[model samples]
Target: MEARLKKTECVKQAPLAQILPPVILGGAGFSYQVYPDPNISQVRQVLRQAFNLGLRAIDTSPYYEPSEELIGQAISEPDFANRYPRDQYIIMTKVGRLGADRFDYSPSWVRCSVNRSLERLHVDYLDVVFCHDIEYVTEEAALDAIGILLEFVREGKVRYIGASSYRIDLLLQLAQSVLDRYGRPLDVVQNWAQMTLQNNRLETDGLKNFRDLGISCVCNASPLTLGLLRSNGVPVGSLGDFHPAPAALRTAALRAADYVAEQGESLAALALRYAIWRARATSTSDFQVSTITGIGSTKELDENISAISQILLPTHGSPINSARVERDAPLWNKVQEILGSWLNFNFTSPEANWDVQQQKFVKLKL
Candidate 1:
């Protein structure tokens, strides 16, 4: 009896989010390019694993290779939807990227995209439909397209409306336009966040400003950073195909690997779990799971889920000083110092060409 009490007390000394709240799963697999050639069989197998692993959220885009079609197949399979009720899951998809890797804001395309997404996912409506990469889109243009999605929301075909990682200027523009023109606020925002502790545009730009305005942020790029974490210490070469970067970014990635090694844990696991730890206060961190990619298989999923669950157990510690200075500030400064020489280049924004200066390593390959 005393041993049981001691064991229970031991379990009570860790962060709760790490162990408890089912980590919102990032579903990008069926269409993820990591696979050689993803077909229906591969897609079904991936979905089977995802559902079995207790993932409640699956995010996809029509742009992902055959992802929509594969999802439809999986959902239509025997007793799948019956077992996992539609409402029990949160499925987020995006519109706006129209013709072959290009972005479009036409209201007609908006409706068409929603309809297509529904058909692909084997559902009548979406839980959330994002404006999908609206950085270069104008407010008026975005609002015109959003008007259509909102109509679907009103008609009960769409549950919520959100945007994924828009330009700060555009984010503010859209939020204000929605309230002033339509009388409501956007529901969520998705951004690129990883354990690297670097928020190039997120920090220096106006991301915090958007956060203050009551928008929930969904973080992407959490696991890619983990790949970097693994390369230096573990000799895990499976990430080769997934790595699309120049030599400089590759070099920085190696350093990121070393840094992660210094922290005593699987870089991949730590990278994925760290986002949940950091973003717990703000919104949710999206896990980018790719069935087609195969970078994360069932085994990896179990390991990740276990890591998250273990981390989130429970804790009783000294009062958390909300006023505590920034985290790993020195480490970030070191990254800046190391990458300072790598970012010296002139480039135009897809929006506009500006005389810009960068101190961190420029990711030309992304």
Candidate 2:
């Protein structure tokens, strides 16, 4: 399978620094939560399967016990590493949390985290490193964290730096802070995004604002939300820590699933296509995924790639793919409620060029 993929044009090229890579394919929380206590070989197969499917980016954090090590073990295999250029695939890892000591944003911890991550992943440098779970860290601590990330940039141990799980205002503030102090804006921003509207803050403001600033974003929790949109709702265990699925959210998800199924499409396909398609349609550089459990084998990879390609192709006045349109309803309203005023910003434009007017000046047209 790897040999056959090596001979194919699996990777589609776009601006590297400008456009975030699509299909990131995450690894954490899979074996433990998604698949129970799986063996090392099973974990290795999952990682290799994701790679074989042309997923170039993989997001992991120290919080997910041994995920980084598992990935390292899988990729270290000669057959896998030889199949893809290490640089061709983006390796994004996070810092700030050590054991149960809480998420630390200080320079000391940042440096320590990077070194430890390198040791675990068996890599010399990282494609991108983000400050994870900044919501719990203080403002000063956040700045200090970014400062340490900058140190890594100077040392060339990290190619770019970003912030994860930060609100729209904080993301914008951090970008400005980076520019003012370092003379450059953030290279990437990691946020929660999905098809069925689990998090509207990203769509209404966060996502648009990031694009306006020329910052690429990697979508976390992209698929599990599909389960949220499913009748059973995405289990809280599946969504990680922040903003677990509530009963209200599950109810909404079931409605979305029922509606999508009525339109003759599967709910899972809708979620995957929606997460990527909307990100590209919005011109926010690129979209990313953490896990491609739905897309592991060569056959599944081919099908998913086709689904993505079909979603992007023109279909006349249709706003989305038939499958997408059928699978789910827009959750923008519910999202706004959850995110509140945080969604108030001027990022949505006429779609000519991805220009976002700053908040202070751009009046809310909505």
Candidate 3:
């Protein structure tokens, strides 16, 4: 999961910083999964390669516990510092949420967190900052914190403001609330694990509302459904601990993974392409989506990049993975057919009253 996908390797990497990528290098895996690996040096190598391959932007947060520091150390190396520079790339971080299951949405915490992130990231300003895990806090608190973020923007501390969540419906409400208070919508949002091959809730429920609320773009994280949709199935015991997916859904996902293997397709590969295409495909109401997938190593990066390349090119006449045929219609159909019962299934928020949060966002609408 490590080789970075350069513009030349994939379909000519679009250089428009103003435009989001079909895929973004996510930080959760690097920070959580790969961080404690005995070989710390490998992490640096992966970061360097990812950047060289045109993954110019990075997404991290304090809640990731030292992800910001790890990223800072990698990029501050003489070669990376001189080559990429601060403005040449994007550094996206989040505030308002602390350790796992802990959150603080106060303006004071927001201000302090942003300043702390600047120090951790070794930068004066962040390119993008989100009110991390807003679903845990009330919507009023989220709006107040978002207002504080805008103040940082006015001070040039961050360029764009976003909110990350598992609840797409709440995210849409928060976006509209931002508009109601200031006559402007959220610049971006990161919705996780909900737009995968098995789940399309973001597209079916979140996007149209977002478009009307004037949200500029959406970032889909955990396209592998936070490792639930992978070939190996959910990691060790991640199912019940942090994830909210109930036992019934978990059993169904395992069954689907087994079925996918029997179909002679790597679930991971097919799932990645499905998400990338789903994000890139235009919505009926003009909602745009960008993907943020985490890779643990250069090897994973190569697989992901090659998957994107395969889907971008035609079914034939390419040196990419032959397994990733240009035509994915049958695979899509089979996935829907096999995992039909699990499609569009979502879990209840384990934290906070969802209606309370939604009401706040709803009231914020203009």
TM-score of each: 0.70, 0.72, 0.83
lDDT of each: 0.53, 0.56, 0.72
List pairs with backbone clashes in candidate 3. Answer: 1-297, 1-299, 1-300, 1-301, 2-297, 2-298, 2-299, 2-300, 2-301, 3-298
Against the hidden true structure, what lDDT does model 3 obtain? 0.72
Q: Write the per-residue lDDT of candidate 3 for residues 9-122, one digit (tens) a residue.
A: 122222222345446788776554334441347558778888777676788888776567777878888887998766566678899767655677888988999999998778
Choose 1 or 3, whichever is better by TM-score: 3
Task: Give the clashing residue pairs of candidate 1, or none.
Answer: 14-314, 18-308, 18-312, 19-309, 19-312, 26-287, 29-290, 29-291, 29-292
Model 1 Cα shift for residue 178 (angstroms): 2.1
Better of 2 and 3 by lDDT: 3
What TM-score number comes out for model 3? 0.83
Cα lDDT tens digits for candidate 1, 165-204: 4355666777777778877666665544322333345444
> Where is model 1 more than 4 Å wrong at Cα?
1-22, 194-196, 200-208, 216-246, 258-264, 283-296, 314-366
In model 3, the Cα lDDT at residue 18 comes to 39
* lDDT at 41, model 1: 72
